[model samples]
Target: MSTKKHKVLVANRGEIAIRIIQACVSLGLDFVCVYTRADEASGHLALARSLGGPNAAYRVSSYHDANEILAVADHAGATAVHPGYGFFAEDFRFARRVAERERSLIFIGPSWRIIRSLGDKINTKRLARSLSIPTVPGSDRPVYDELEAEEIAETLFAFQAEQGISNSVVLVKASAGGGGMGIEEIYDIEQFKTVYRRIRNYAKRQFHDEGVLIEQRIFDFNHLEVQIVADRTGTGIVHFGTRNCTIQSTGRQKRVEIAPGFRPQEVDYAFDAEKLMEDIVGYSLAMAREVGYDNVGTWEWIVSPTGQPFLMEVNTRIQVENGVSAAISRVRGQGGVNIIAEQIRLGLGEPMGYDQSNITFDGVGIEYRIIAEDPANRFTPWVGRIDQFLAPTLPYASLHTHIPMDEPYEIPTEYDPNLALAIVWGKDLAEAKKRGVDYLDELTLSGADGTGTELKSNVRFLRDKTSTILQF
Candidate 1:
């Protein structure tokens, strides 16, 4: 294949946009970036302008809807559309529109139909069960009333005949929700009824979708995940190792995230988690094969103390930690600089040499999502000009910092609070933790005293160390 330059239009904003622009530059492709009026002076737009020459950068006049973004892609004459990990990235309808709008405007992800299938919680649970994937015990469909929930519980009991679950604690989750919303635990059927009603009302008021899901709750578990990449050519699959995210202590207090969260807290039960990762990767590969999933995706799972890992959900596009995944993919020589590069190549009809021999380096990699939140006030989002900023340092490892050195960084109230990502690779888990700690300690954010540690207790470092110095 000739290495001809292709113009890529990123359909999102923020640090991820800059990351995609860099990837385009690395692969000798022109980048066309679009942003709202609010983001005209944002770091992402600034970086995009700096990367591409005149007439290559495109800025939209207004923020209408997903279709407006797609229209920008069409006007720019972009060969491919990358949704970047938020907004319409996982929206199946949006993907279908991109596919049908233009032949060359590849969606850069799994097909629209497959995305919609997995988009619904009910359908996803069914698919997981059929593939022998361990999913949280939940209602088969949306429960509209208390009696229907009871009936669903009876069916769940029948399904749980082999396992001993007498006092079942359930969680009411939304059928079409994510980002930690629409999930509440219930200790009794009455509580489940109440929580379900609350969730249903919230969903109706917010999403205009009154769908509710009930599932058994797993307590004191480690939030773990596995990432998988596949293609339509039936080339084998790739697993980008695993990550341990056990530091989400979101009760009434705030805490700093330490690697290994709590030493020996789950050491006696980690084997079960390893097995769960294997199963998750296997299930993801099977699902991809079943529906012809191409490009990159991830399967998330939660592991209990008993070593049982249950699939939580799946993300259909590049994730917040795409930097780490991209590094792994590149070290293995599987694709270009980023997952989008690989997706573009696959969409343009290129051969995928999915060889294990291509993947290199077996070190530990970890990412810390630096958000603009105040720990004292329940981790509320901090928005303003970043008057001062200093990135952390990494030793004995490769460091990838996403924040630009511009005098002012934009923090808007219309979106997520994740400001930047600090990805580091170390010789071992403990060493990786040390590097992470040292790196976090050097961050000097302005419009604030130092790093907000309210959510420090919820911060996970993925190491076995109990305590580490992180003085910023």
Candidate 2:
């Protein structure tokens, strides 16, 4: 319970690492950060060194190497490990090791058991169904048997047909696959078997598991998430609200996220937006309490075009979009809520001093994940040198980036070139959109690849999506 004695080792890199360091500082705690050779120029390492005193940043061979991470943690005398999204963020085994090791370090996330239980999409669906929580209409478990898989596919197609959904589509994906891998869509029931076999084969070859998940792919659904935070005891669970993550790349990677999920006052929707948001928040809290979720987590939900909200899965770690939710959230009539700091504090065995009623939301907040990628080319990674990276100087807007602004930074090819996160807030949704576009317009981000090719980014794509956000 004594957080001051804790020295956290940030087991990840990039802007998230910086966020974790800052969160630790805000909590009056020491911290260490690690990076690979390719990430030497990252701002996270620089900030950690500047703020974390001597030997704050450690050089590692690979971020995914648990032994290296643990060694660094031991060398730096770290008492806790914060896997800031990606890498070992959702890996239950990693979390377990951080807890069960002889010289254990606190895992700054949900417990290992909770991560393992909720990490399985199929298991999460079953849990939701048991609680009468709505999940996407699909087979809960892996359809390993061909006959059984085809029957589930036919039933899904028939169910969609009865719902008056046109151009019916069924998703056949490796149940064990993740990050949009080993998945394909089938429009024809006859073609379902072929696609299923191909995916099953791909799953076996790739994941060594031929388990396939068949589900009705609901078109025009908005990808939403509920941000849940709990105390170390899991007895206190409060929500920071929901986010609209429908603006994504063709690869299903999120590019833009907005808090509050929907704005029924500004844009009209098919279903009751406020009611839907409340329902998702309630369901998320219910599940979190059910599992004794003792830290920060995100409950992803997909709402169909007709307004049915279905639980997608649970992220047992702090999410990248968490900052957007914090931007608009206020507690005890005070603003400037830093969710990362809250997660660190709560993860380090802190008590939830305040109740849900003490927390209040202010204005609309929009977060733009500015990355060096060609959105026109299916979001191809744009690797090059960043020459001039300028951020907007607006009071309502804040940006987080690992690429330094004073000097040219070569966008490392070994990792994703996510340049920055531009978060803009406004008193209302319309104002937020205006400020978001203005922030993008004012942003001076220019770079070139090795061949002198101009950097292609999702700035334009993000700008365009600002006008149509939450309009489902």
Candidate 3:
């Protein structure tokens, strides 16, 4: 067992695994990756070894089970495990098990305690309030039934000060949901009844939590968020700047995400874009210091029309835009990704080569998630193997995808179709958007080719029609 080279089990698939594997290589560490029955020939596995050294090992098996991954990590004598967002990335129980594994397999990212705390939207709201961060106006606890929700909403309407509501529509949301699941917009009791039942059933089936929360939804608002990183020693705290994701639809099934959305022509961010970025970074840093936050975390927020910034939620893992944001950080001379690596090093009590001041982000980068669903057909998700895949190459942009080249990419219906991420970076946001359009135009697939040519055509058509420039 070579103590000098850390052996890390990459308990994830897709572009994220490739990203982490690259980081491991940069640190001169040994790489280990696992795949499911469906992903035995995934690009993630191939890329992991292609970038790894001869000493590096790759395993293809059923890592579909959390316990299964743990057993493999234990048997492989892995020193640490990195869950690269998605799959079991935010699973608190999985994190706990990884930590409990013998031979000291450090679980990358925040402690299991923090994951659980942030996983529950109610608990996160309470914590945000305690820290003086304005969270979405909602009940401090979960709502049990329609009657309970109606009472809460009516009370809020009457008091007007309870949830800052002066007879306005509110969003009924599930405490445990991501990717826009278990949510509905309601105005009256009838609407509430219709939406709540559907949402409650979805929540119970998805998260086993029938309890939901009612929050004041911001309409026609520009969405802004800050990405923060905290070190284990509680010494280094940094923010990687802000991203505007305003382009959205009120649709329940599918919503469009435009990164670096056009500057709000009407309303500005709750805080000065630059100031809010720093403040959010500062607030999260202070909170992490108090609570001993470790690894990567993001303080999600939305800026209202009145320029009041409200904390929406906190994600205790590498967020969906992590790679894109990392590109931004590197261009700005900030160490977003480096900080995470340093935190991992410090948690292990190992000397790290992290110079917070020296790290820089080089260009504006945008990533568009290409899902395996038809955008025109109510965004119906297409499952099964992808028979063919033809990726695009943009100017100064590279594709980090899961679709295997020259082979059938077997995609299961069990998980989400993060088929590929079209990552494009430019000298600025404008160039990134142009590249994104071009990249979207060029992506191709077969049976499970992710939203197919028609999807790309619609996106491009809309981009041209809107003449509206946004980079994601």
Candidate 4:
């Protein structure tokens, strides 16, 4: 276990790349950023060069090409690689490759064995059951074909009848899928038969795996997740609290709030706040220990209307909304722990710096994911050259984006449409939401004026109070 981090390569793009670069700088480690030709002019690459000097950036044919990234890492003598939340972040093979590389390049995430186990939804649920953690009732095995899906659906319906639950729906999900893709909601037997094949085909095409799992869909439930960090020694600490990710559209998160379940007055929820939090944290830590999970991860769950929490899945990488938890942790005076830095340290076999007692959650933090898409046109990607881009300088708000303000910026058509993330903290949720929307309003991104072709974003959507309101 060495504390020294010589050089690290960030194997992702967008704000997360910039985030890891900043963390590297904070830790006084040499940082390298790999980019596709499409991202040659990305703000993340520019920032990396600015922070790490001339030799900080490299270009690859594609970000998803692991061989090219590893070649560059070898060429640059990188000791570690950080897959920042997407692409190969959860790829067990990639993690194993990095670990077994001749140079001994460390992958800043959980062990490959743990990633392989938890990456499969079916295995994750099975492990949860083994640990006595509550899970949503669903198919016990992979639903490969229509017959298996039909059988599972029948079993689910029978169980629903036994439990006296009517109008229940089942979620057909890809066992190896992520980011809310390759999932279909089946309402009845007919729908199950129709969607089962489609979901398997989708899973095959998207994730390269045809394995699917069915879970009882809990409607009108709150999406909550706990952030936890673990070390090789089995020492772990869950974050100060939970994040409410219920504010979503089309199964994707639009906004996330920390301590979301703290407001017991506004929403009539049946769960005991103390016990629920304990369960979430307890289950997450216990699972991490079971798998020898080292580094940062998130445990996501759905809280039913009756206050029962069902384990959904585990994310073996940093989450998109982790900034809200970081903001809250900083306000609690815990020395503003940098999760990425901690991740690198943990990968280097360093022990966790803090424990549960040291972690604290204070105030409210909210994050709005600002995507460069036309909401009026069904969220179509608004790709163009940015003539001017300006973000607010609010004290309580932090903007994470790779959209450059200086010079012309071209929005690549090859990647996610997410342009930026605006995170704000306040004394309470109301103020956090208000300031978050205000900060979003202050942002401006447009094509050159008089071109009569301006790029549209979802700023207005973030300001909609009705959309921000939480539903139990």
Candidate 5:
């Protein structure tokens, strides 16, 4: 690990790219940005230009092209590369390529060896079992063909029948997928072959992996995740404060809240929250140590109605809802450790600056992902130029976006469905909900009038009172 200030290359775009640029500026480090041709005039590129110094920006055909991104990094003399959130953030091959580089460029996330071991869902579950961590019952190996899928389905059905249980739904998920993609639900055992084939095809096309993993889908469960940060020396801290992401409809996160309020009147599940948090933190750290994980990562779990917490998966990159955790730490007087800065320092062989005792959750935090889609029209893609964009200005509230304020605000053509993120912290869950709703009400994005615009946003949906309530 080199102790010198590094020149980092941002290999992704959108709000995350802008966030990394800000982190670089704060650390007094040089950074270069790569963008697609469609984003030549995007707000993120403009931001890089405005913060010009040793920073350089390049245009590539695709953000997923590892070779082209490395070429630009090499030409710009970047000492490190940051793959923010999506795209190549968890790409083991990309990490390996960076590590194998002749010029010695650092990959800001986990080591390639660790990524290769845990990137596969099946392998990760097996690792959890080896470590005595509870996991959802499912196939212990990858399902490569329809026969294997049918066998696993029969096995699960027999097991459920032996236990005298009905409504046992199983999920066929891609072994190498992330961001809630490459998953299909199988409610009936007879439908396993067809659904498995479809899922495998989808997985191959999308994730470039035909291998699939089967898991017992627990209904009426809550989705929770624990955030963890570690260094090469094995020092780590688990932000025990959990987040409730159970308000999703189609397995996609619409809204997320930290320190989820569990009303006894709402659900039947009963457990000691403190004990659960301690167990989760211990399990996550044990797994991280097993894999030699360094940098920031998340451990996701699905808690059943019976209060049984099962490991779902592990995210090897910074999550989209990171602002909520940061706000919670900041309000708790923990100085809101900058996760990106820690990643850089860990890659440079520095010990974790803080320990577990330094972490304290003081308040409630919530985050809403404002995507450019029509909720009434099956969440169809809505893309257009913005004539006006106004976000709310509130204390303890943060907005991460690249939407510009000019005569004509145009969104890039080649990008994901996300538009922006609004994160707010409050004294408690109720106050957080109120602040979040107010912020959403103040957010405005409209296209040019009389332009026959089909563009829409979820701002109205997020502002609705029902949006704040947790629903399974």
Candidate 6:
């Protein structure tokens, strides 16, 4: 509650920008937001004008342009920069520049050093292994040598073979590239060298870094995440439970997320779901402490059919599903947990006046990412103006979105067609699942593309998966 003098520069757009502005309002912090010409109709800009100062919204040429954002911050006299999840959220170089610039501004996430250290997949693997944490068997660092990369790939195939995996697979990805780019999978050891050289060449051309990471490709696994929070001191580490992110798109993008990772009560899982959650949380905290991670971050993991867990990577910023985790969590038995606000407070050198013992988890929370897209058609985006968007208001449901309900809005093609996030919670998984379906059924979202085709959204896809959300 001490950030009255601090002003925040919201460096992203859409629903995330709206959420950050709301968090700033709740924290009594001044804020400014920027948007390109394409996002002129975004609700975040309107919200800023209504709640913030006269100069709350600024028109920038691009959101990815760091100089544009910093210039706006200086012009607005903002003291901190909040990169809401995307854009510069995980860019350590941007964070470093924000702090090291002549008119230094606070980067509202982990410190620049921590971001740089954990942003690299190769370095994160090494760091996890150094702490005796479980990670997929792979090269801890980049394999620049072709012979060494092949050795690692061979070892991975043998490891998979040892695990009784019939179709052994190895994944070769550029250590520097992210978001599933510069990666390929090989089923045959004979083809390993071929794929390795190809990816290495691509990595050099794309990222200017020839360092390649060859690892055992994990398939048929449940994606889970442990949310970690800490203060600037790095010792006030605590977890916001776990969530099951298994149900994803054909491209492996999460669409529905439910808190309390595995529902042992609802499904007969092979692994002790509760204990596994605790173990992963402990491992995540250990790693966070090991690297002095000093803000909100996610420890992403993959749980195999047998319940074996492996550290996937670290997201050094607040994720889109963070509100789902907060929905199921309570601080000192009270429920309004806003993690984005916590990230801002902590990033500005605020104290975590409470610890893990003060926190408790209750009820099951679910979040459905509402997008103007067709799930059946490989989750292809639907671009057009939305004439109807009706968000239901329920006591147990919370909707976070940048799309306006009172007016028709155009679905911008410049960004992902993600329209909104519907979050609901209930006493248990059964009730939560029911409420989720009800929300989807009652909601109305329609739009049309240039061809005058009817709107196609993932509402049907989200409802269809509600029946199997937390089932192990």
List the candidates ranked by lDDT, beginning with the highest: 2, 6, 4, 5, 3, 1
* Candidate 1 lDDT score relative to the true structure: 0.62
lDDT by residue (130-201, candidate 4, tens digit) is 999998898866767778778888888778878888787888888777777777887777787678888888
Off by over 4 Å in 6: 143-151, 177-183, 189-212
Give lDDT per model, in order.
Answer: 0.62, 0.91, 0.65, 0.78, 0.75, 0.90
* Residue ranges of candidate 2 with Cα displaced over 4 Å: 143-148, 176-182, 197-210
Error of 1 at 432 (Å): 0.6
For residues 425-468, write the lDDT of model 1, one tens digit per residue. Answer: 55555666677667666666665324542222112332222233
Q: How far out, in Å, is residue 48 in model 1?
A: 0.9
Q: With candidate 1 superimposed using the best TM-score fit, by how many Å does residue 209's alpha carbon deviate from the native?
A: 1.6
Clashes of each: 16, 0, 14, 0, 0, 0
Q: lDDT at 245 for candidate 5?
A: 68
Candidate 6 shows a clash count of: 0
TM-score of 1: 0.83
Report the number of the highest-TM-score candidate: 2
**Number of clashing pairs, model 5?**
0
Off by over 4 Å in 1: 1-3, 61-64, 102-104, 144-147, 150-168, 249-276, 326-337, 393-404, 448-472
lDDT by residue for model 5 over 1-472, one digit each (tens)? 3445688899988888998888888777888998888887677788888896435788888998988999999999898899988888888999999989787788888878777777766778889999999998988777787787787878877777787777777888887676667778887888888888888988889878788888777778877887777776655544545666665536465455554434333333467555665677778788988787877888888887667789888888888877677777742355565667666667666776666676776667788888777777766667777777788788878888877766565666577657788888777666777888788877777773236765688777767733545443
Question: Which whole-number lDDT from 0 to 100 does residue 458 have in model 4?
Answer: 75
Between candidates 3 and 4, which one is better according to TM-score? 4
Residue-wise C-alpha lDDT for candidate 6, range 292-386, written one tens digit per residue: 88999999998887788999899999999999999999999999999999999988998898999999999999999998888879888889999
In candidate 2, residue 222 scores what lDDT?
95
Q: What is the per-residue lDDT of model 2 for residues 1-472, given as tens digits with 9 covering 90 to 100?
A: 4889999999999999999988888889999999999999999988988897658998999998999999999988999999999888888999999999999999999999999999889889999999999998899988789999999999998998897878999999898776567778999788977898899999999778999999888788899999999998979999999999999888788889999899888899988889999999999999999999899999999998889999988888889999899999999989999999999999989898998999999889999999999988989999999999998688998888888999999888898889999999999998999999999999898888878899899999999999998888
Model 2 alpha-carbon miss at residue 315, Å? 0.9
What TM-score, over all chains together, does every model reach?
A: 0.83, 0.95, 0.83, 0.93, 0.92, 0.94
